[model samples]
Target: MSAVSAVATDRAQADAAVVVAWCDELADITAEPGRITRVYLSPEHARVNAVVGGWMRDAGLRTWQDAAGNLHGRVDGSTADARTLLLGSHLDTVVDAGRYDGIVGVLMAIRTVARLTAAGPLPSAVEVIAFSDEEGTRFGKALLGSSAVAGVWDDGWWDLEDGDGTTLRRAFTDFGLDPESVGTAAADPSTLIGYLEAHIEQGPYLDRAGQALGVVTSIASARRFSVEAVGEARHAGGTPYERRHDALLAAAEAALAVEGICRASQHIGTVGTMTVEPGAVNVVPGLARFSVDLRGEFDEGRDRVWDAITAAFDEIAVRRGVAVEPTEVHRAPAVFCAPALMDALRTGIVSTGEAAPPALFSRAGHDAMSLGLVTDVGMLFLRNPDGISHHPDEFVAEADIALGLDALAVAVRTLTERHGTGPDGVS
Candidate 1:
C-alpha cells in the first residue's frame, strides 16, 4: 500500500480504538441488571450515577447533580463567563436497554475531554452532562434533565407520578438532589453559545442509504392519548350475541379504526398498547383502555391524524351504543435544529471522505429538542444496524462510530476556533 494509504489506515484504527474503549467502559456500568431497570432515583440507578460521578472526579472535573437529577461535569476555560460547549447524553434507559443507547454520548464526551486535558487548556470550556432521565422508563417523563435546564419543567411537571405512588419531587430528594433548586440548572442564554450531542441514529435511514453520518433537520412532533370504552358487562355464555354490549368488542372495533387512521395517514399514527379491564374468560369486558401515539413531520399533519382518529372513535362509540373518552397525555411540536450547525456537520462529513450525510428528521425525541428552546443545539446521528435502537441487540459498526466521532470533533473544533464558546455568536 502507498505510504499515505497506510497512514490513513493507521489513523482509522486508532479512532476505532478510542470509540471501543468508551463503549466498553459504559458497557461495564450498564451490564448490572439493576442499572438496566427503571432508575427513577432508585437504589440501583443511584449506584450507577455514583460510579459515573467518580469517573468524572478522577479526571479532575468538578461534578454537580442538578435538581432534575442530571449529573454535570464542568471544565473551566480561560473565562468563567464563557458558554461551554456542552456534550453528553442521558444515562437513564428503558428496561433492559443496551449499554450504548444514551451512555455512549457521555463516554465519548468524557474521553474527548480527557484527551484535551492532556494536551493543555482549550480555548473554551466543555461540559459533559449525564442527563438524569431521558427514557421516561421510571416516571414516564422524557428529557426531564434537559427540560429543567431549559426552564420548561414546572411545578405541575414536578409532581408527575410514576407507576408507583412516588412523585418526582420525592424521588429527587431521595436521590440527594433538591427539587426547589431545579431552576438553577437553567443556563444563561448568553452563555450557551451552542450545544452539540452525538447519538445513535436509532433508525434505519442511514444504514440503508449507505451513509455513516446523519445531519438532523428536525425532530418530529408527537401526540399521545388514552382511549377508554364503557359498555355493560354480560355473561358470555348466558347472553345472546345480539343483546351483548361488550366493551372489549367495541375496543377491538376502535383498534381497527386506529389502524385505519394510521393507514389513511400513511402510518404516522401508531397504537402500541391496548387492554381490557375485568379481564376474564367467561365475562364480556365492561371497560377497555388503550393508548394511541401519533407522530408526523408537521403540526398540520399531526392535527389531521388527530381529527380523523377522534372522528372514527366517535363513530364507533355511537354504532356500538358505547361511550368512549380519549384523554390527552402530551403533545410536542416539531423542533428544527440550527441550520448553520447542520451545514457544519455536512462539511465535516465531506472532509472525512465518508459517503454523503443523510439529511433526515428524527422520529425519536431528544434532549436537544428541549435545549433548542434556550440555546443553539445541534445533533449528529451515528448510523445504527437496521436503524434499530432502544433494545439490547441494537448495533452500530465500529467504522461508523469512528466516522461519527471524526465529524463531531470537526464540528466542535470549528465552533470553538471561531466562536470561543461565548454566547454572542451562537444565537
Candidate 2:
C-alpha cells in the first residue's frame, strides 16, 4: 500500500480497537439479565452514565448537568465564540436493552474529542451530551431533554404521568433536578450551526445493503389517534347475532380498514399499534378502543393516509350502526435537516474511503428530530447486526463502529472548517 493508503488503514485498525474497548466497558456496566431482562429505568442505566461521565472528566472535558438531568461535557475550541457542534444519544433503553443501542454514538463522540484534544487546537467547540430521556421508558414522553433545548417543552408536558403516577416535573425534582432549570438548556437557534447524532441502524436495511454508515436526511412525522366504538353490552348467547350492535365487530372492521388503507396507499402509510378494552372471554364487548399510528415522510402524504383511515372509520360506523369517535393522541411534524450538513457527512464518509448510503428518515423518533427545529441537524447510523434495536439483542459489529467513528470525525473536521464562527459566534 502507498503511504497514504497505509496511514488510512492504520487509522481504521486503531479506531476498531477503540470501538471494542467501548463495548467492553459497557458490558462491564450492564447486568447478566441485560440479555433478556429489560434495562429500562433500572439502576444499571444510571450506573453506566456515571461511569461514562467519569471517563469524560478524565479526558479533560468540563462536565455539568441541566435541569432536565442531561449531562453535558464541553471540549473547548480555539475560537471563543464558535458555535458548538453538539453530538449525543439517549442513555435509557427498552427492556432487555442491547448494549450498543445508544451508548455507541456517545462514546464515539467522547473518543473523538479525546483524540482531537491530543492533537491540540480545535476550530470550533464540541459538546457531547447524554440526553436525559429519549426511549420514553420512564415518562412515556420521548425527546424530553431535546425538546427543552428546542424551547418546545411546556407546562402540559410537565403534567404527563409516568408508570408510578408521578408527574414528569415531580420526578425531575425527586431526582434532584429542578424543573425551572430546564430553560437553561435552551440553545440559540443560529448559534447551533449543526447537531449530529450517531446511532445504531436498528434495522436490517444497511446490513443487507452491505453499507456501514447511514446519512439521515429527514425525520418522519407521527399522527396517533385513539378510536372508541360503543354499543350496548350483552351476553354472548343472549344477543342475536343479526340484531347485535357489536362494538367489537366495529373495532375489527376499523382495524382491517387501517391495514387496507396502508396497503392501498402504495406504501406511504403504516398502522403499528392497536388495543381493545374490556378483554374478557364471556362478556360481549360493549366498548372497544384502539389506536391508529400513521407515519410519513411528508405532511401531504400523512394527510392523505389520515383521510383514508377516517373515511374507513365513518364507513364502519355506518355499517355497524355504532358510534365511533377518534381522539388524536399526538402529532409531530416531519422535520428535514440542513442540506449542507447532509452533504458534508457524505463527503466525510467518502473521504474515509467508505460508502455513504443515500439519506433516509427514521421510522422511530429520536432526540435529533427535536433539535432540528432549533439548529441545523444531521445523523449517522452505525450498522446493527440484524437491524434490530431498542431490545437486548440490538447490536453492531466492531468494524462497523470504527467505520461510523471515522465518518463522524470527518464530518466534524469538514463542518468546523467550513462553518466555524471563531470568537464572534456563528460567523
Candidate 3:
C-alpha cells in the first residue's frame, strides 16, 4: 500500500480501538458491580462525564458539561459564528446494559471530529453530545437530556421520583446542579444546521441482510398505556367459580388480547410490567395492573392497534364483571429523516465501497425523536449480530465499528459540502 494509504489505515484502526476501549471503560462505571446500570444524575454519570470530557479535550475540542448533565465537545469551523452540526447519542444505559447501544455513537462522533480537524477546519462547526438519560429506567421519563436541548423540557417532571424516593429536582441538587438552570441547556434552533445520530440497529434486519450499516428512514410512533383491572376480593376456596371476580384473570385475558391483535397486524405490542394486589395464598386478587407498549411505522396503524386493545378491554370488563382502565402515559409520533441528510448518508455509505444502503424504520425510540421537534434529523444504524440490545449479550463486530466511523466522517464531509455553512446556504 502507498504510505498515505497505510497512514490512513493505521488511523482508522486507532479510532476503532479508542471507541471500543471507551465503551469498555464506561461499562465499568455502572451502578451495579459486575453489571452495567448507569442512570441520570447518578455518581456514575458524573464520573463518565469526567472521563469522556477528557477524551473530547484530547481530540482537540472544547469540552463542557451542559446544565442538563450532557457532555459536549465542540470543534470550531472556519468562522467562530458558523452554524453547528450536532452529532451524538445518549450515554445512560438500561438495566444490565450492553456496552455499545448509545455510548459508541458519542465516542465515534468525537473520533470523527478528530479526523476532520486533523488538517484544518471545515465549513461549519461540529459538536458532539453525550446525553445524560434516554432509557427512562431511573425515573420513568425518557429523553430528559435531549428534551432539554430541544427546549421542550416539562417542568412537571420535577416531581418525578426514582426507586429511592428521590425526586428529580432533589437528584439535580445532589448532583451539584441547580434545577433552575436546566433551561440554559436549550439551543437556538436557528443556530443548528442539523442533527445526526449513529446507533446500533438493535434488530436483525441489517445482520440478516449481511450488511454492516443501514440508513434510517423514520422512527416508529409509540404509545404506552398503564392498564388496570379492578375486581372484588373474595375467598378462593369458599367462593364458587361463577361467583368470584378475579382481577388477575381479567388482566391475563387483556394481555393475551393485546398480543393477539398486535400479532395479527403489522404493529408490535409488549406487556412489559405487571403487578397484582393483595398477596395471599387463597384469596382472590383485588386489583391488577400491567404496562402496555405499542409501536408501528405509522401513527395511524399504532392508534388502530390501541383502539383494538381498548375494545378488548371493554368486552373483558363487561363479561368478567370487572372494571378495566387504560391510561395513556406516553406518546411519540413517527419522525421522518431529512431528505438532504439521507442523501448525504447515501454518499457516505457509497464512499465506503459498500453496496448502496437499505432504509429501515426504527422500532425503538431515540433521542432523535425529541430533537426532531426542532431540527431536521437523520440516523445511521450499525449492525447488531443477534438483533439484541438493552441486554449484556448485545454485541457489534469491531470491523463494523470501523466502517461506521468512516461512514459517519464521510457523511459529515458531504453535509459540509452540500450545505456550506448552514441549511439556508445549501447549494
Candidate 4:
C-alpha cells in the first residue's frame, strides 16, 4: 500500500481501538457494580459527562452540559458563524445493557471531529451531543433529553416518579439541574444544517445482508399503553368457576390478543411489564395491569393494530365480566430520513468500498425521532451480528466500527461539499 494509505489504515485502527476502550471504561461508570445501568439525571450521568467532556476538550472543541443534562461539544467551521451539523446519540442505557449501543455513537462522533480538526476546519461546524436519557429506565419517559432539545418538553412529566418515589423534578434538583431551564437546551432550527446519528442496527438486517453499514430509511412510529383489567377479588375455593371474574385471566387473554393482532398485521408488539394484585394464591386477582409497546414502519399501520387490540380488549372484558381500560403513556410518529441526507449517507457507504448498502427502516425508536421534530435527520446503522440489543450480549465487530466511523466521516464531508461552499467556504 502507499504510504498515505498505510497511514490512514493505522489511524482507523487506532480510532477503533480507542472507541472499544472508551466503551469498556464507560461501562464501568454505571450505578450497578458489574452491570451497566445509567439513568437520567443520576450520578452516573454526571460522571460520564466529566469523562466525555474531557475528551471533547482534548479534541479542541468548546464543551458544555445543556440545561436538560445532555453533554455537548462543538468545533467551529471555516467561520465561527457557519451553520452547524449535529452528530450524536443517547448515552443512557437500559438495565444490564450492552457497552456499544448508544455510547459508541458519541465516542465515534468525538473521534470523527478530532480527526477533522486535526487536519483543518471543515466548511460547517460540527457538534457532538451525548443525550442524558433515551432508555427511560427510571421515570419511564423515553427521549427526555432529545425532547428538550426539540422544544417539546411536557410540563406534566415533572410529576413522574421513579421506583424510589423520587419525582423527576426532585431528581433534577438533586442532580444539580434546574427544571425551569430545560428550555435553554432547545436549538434554533434555522441554525442547523442537519442531524446525523451512527448507531448499531440492534437487529439482524444488515448482518443478514453481510454489510458493515447501511443507511436508515425511516424510524418506526411507536405507541405504549398501560392496560388494566379490574375484577372483584373472590375466594378461589368458594367462588364457582362460572362466577369467578379473574382479572389475571382477562389480562392473559388480552396479552395473547395483542400478540396475535400484531403478528397478523406484520407489526411489532410487546408486553414488557405486567402486575397482578392479590398476593394470596388462594384469592382471585382483583386487578391486572400490563404495559403494551407497539411499533410499525408507518403510523397508520400502528394505529390499525392498536384499534384491533382495543377491540380484543372489549371482547375479553365482556367474556370475563371484567372492566378493561388502556391508557396511552407514550407515542412517537414515524420520522423519514431527508432525501439529501440519505443521499449523502449512501455516498458515504459506497465510499467505504461497499457496492450498494441496503436501506432499512429502524424498528426501534431513536433520539433522531425526537430531533426530527426540529430538523432534517438521518441515521447510519452498523451491523450487530446477533441481532441483539438492550442486553449484555449485544455485539458489534471492531472492523465494523472502523468502517462505520469512516462512512460517518465521509458523510460529513459530503455534507460539507454540498452546503459548505455556499455560505461558509470549505477549508
Local accuracy of candidate 4 as per-residue lDDT tens digits, 1-427: 1111211245666898899999989999999998999999888999999999999999898999999999999988897567888999989999999999889999999998898778899988889999999889899899999999999999999999999999999999999999999999998887788899999998999888777788999999999999999998999999998999999999999999999999999999999889999858999998999999999999999998899999999999999999999999888899999988888888877766776778999999899999899888999998898789999989887778887778788889888656753443221
Q: Kindly list the per-residue Cα lDDT of model 3 for residues 379-413, writing each as its tens digit.
A: 99989997999999998877788878888888898
Q: Write the per-residue lDDT of candidate 1 for residues 163-253, one digit (tens) a residue.
A: 7788888888888888888888887666655778888888888778766677888888899999889988888899887777788888888
lDDT of 1 at 7: 16
Candidates 2 and 4: which is better by lDDT? 4
Better of 3 and 4 by TM-score: 3
Question: Could you tell me how far off, in angstroms, the CA of residue 301 lies in candidate 4 after the best superposition?
Answer: 1.0
Top-TM-score candidate index: 3
Residues forming the 10-long window of minimal summed lDDT in candidate 3 = 1-10
> Cα deviation in Å at residue 136, candidate 4?
0.9
Backbone clashes in model 4, listed as residue pairs: none
Task: Name model 3 segments beyond 4 Å from true.
Answer: 1-10, 422-427
For the record, the alpha-carbon RMSD of candidate 1 to the native fold, in angstroms, is: 3.2
Mark the 10 consecutive residues where model 2 has the least summed lDDT.
1-10
Instruction: Tell me the TM-score of model 2.
Output: 0.90
Which ranges in model 4 have alpha carbons more than 4 Å from their true place? 1-8, 421-427
RMSD of 2: 3.4
